[model samples]
Target: MIPNVIRRVEFQYCKLHFLLRTRPLSHVMYSGSTGLVTPVADPSLLDCSRAAAQDVDGFAIISNFVSSEEEEQLMVDIRRTLRGRKYLYDHWDGAIEGYSETEKSNWSESNTPVIQRLKAVAAAAVTDKVVVPLEQVHVLDLAEDGHIKPHVDSVKFCGEVICGISLLSDSVMQLQHEEYPDRWIHALLSRFSLYIMRGVIRYKYTHAIPTNENSVFKGERITKQRRVSVISRTQPVHS
Candidate 1:
């Protein structure tokens, strides 16, 4: 079982622009360039008020999971490899679909050296009982304001454990539990951060990034920076 500090956190407000005022609790605020402000409530103090209670979802966000140097080099390689490649869509793949704007996929199978490095890192990161091979990995690129609607990965295509490594800029991912539709979890995925979702969190939840605004927090609307995500799965369908 994960420790108490690592438990799930629930946020009171879901709006892109809102302030959370809780006395005696330290708050961190992120300002977007569009003059929108999102106030991050103190998770520790969130337990006090019953009225402030929100749905709790099992999603883990680990900031700075990869070193800065590693993230930079990986992104550089991704850009170089994608320059001349054709982007395609396979309906059989469930994580993403439909007329999405400015996005690319399937770098995990590319011959780029940086992609090779990513495979190495993913292999090393899977220390659990389930060993996920590199062949099941998938890479994605999202442009500014690009959004992916809420959807769950097909059970057959992914492992029991799913890991997403963020590269460049930041994004707010919203997740909802199928069993508890009322409650949702919003996470700020920063550059080099890794988010791991498993157990009920893995199979029972739907996740997506919103497309309306570039940044969720006020005054934080910095220009959209190209972003990449390396998705690693530990449980292969064939094995």
Candidate 2:
């Protein structure tokens, strides 16, 4: 028998080779300059099909959460808002430890720019599908070099349910813990895809995207596309 190490490497290489030849790369997934197993038929709500991918805590990845027309419009709106605005070093500080107070202060005034259509669609998903009310709403715009480090959002300020929609490009977001540093839960945020994090996914596993040049998925190098994410949360709750 081949050594286990060689076996693993050979298996992964074969898998990767098969994927590259059989599936079209999704510019939407890493941005397809490129593609997965069967996705749910309608991802407007949580689908049991992805239950296996969820960690004990809980996480959901919804593909085609928004239509192509909506995505195009959202991109226009996202670019407009992103223009002429000064971006800060980190938008995640408040969601993590120690900076809860500072982050909470901006919450009230921040929802003004989020497009109504986008907000309505997300809220509909939450209320109709997830059966929860919408709460905090904001955007995280990633520059070519921008990415939020691995950090847990503070439960003291943010709510239990967190939902977000990607715009402009595709990027990878990962979840992992210090205890199991070697294991990572990755969500490929394709443009217009919806990602919801709650339960263990929210409180336990820390999530982040590496800085632009450092981005990768499945051991493959990827380009950083300027990403605009509209994120919302419910009232603060115990996670």
Best by TM-score: 2
Which regions of candidate 2 are displaced past 4 Å? 1-57, 79-83, 90-132
Q: Give the per-residue Cα lDDT of candidate 2 at 29.
A: 19
Q: Tell me, what's the RMSD of every candidate?
A: 12.0, 15.1
Worst 10 residues of 2 by lDDT: 96-105
Candidates' C-alpha lDDT: 0.50, 0.52
- TM-scores vs. true structure, each candidate: 0.58, 0.60
Q: How many backbone clashes does candidate 1 have?
A: 12
Clash count of each predicted structure: 12, 6
Q: lDDT, candidate 1, residue 101?
A: 23
Candidate 1, 1-239: lDDT as tens digits: 22321221111122211222221112323222222223344352112123213323234454455566667666665667567544333334444432222223344322233333333333333333534544645667766546567788777766656667788877777666677656556667777766656555567768776664644533344333656787776655564
Q: What is the lDDT of residue 82 in candidate 2?
A: 54
Candidate 2, 101-201: lDDT as tens digits? 11111321122322332233233332223323344356566676666778887767565567777777777776775466554576666667767676556
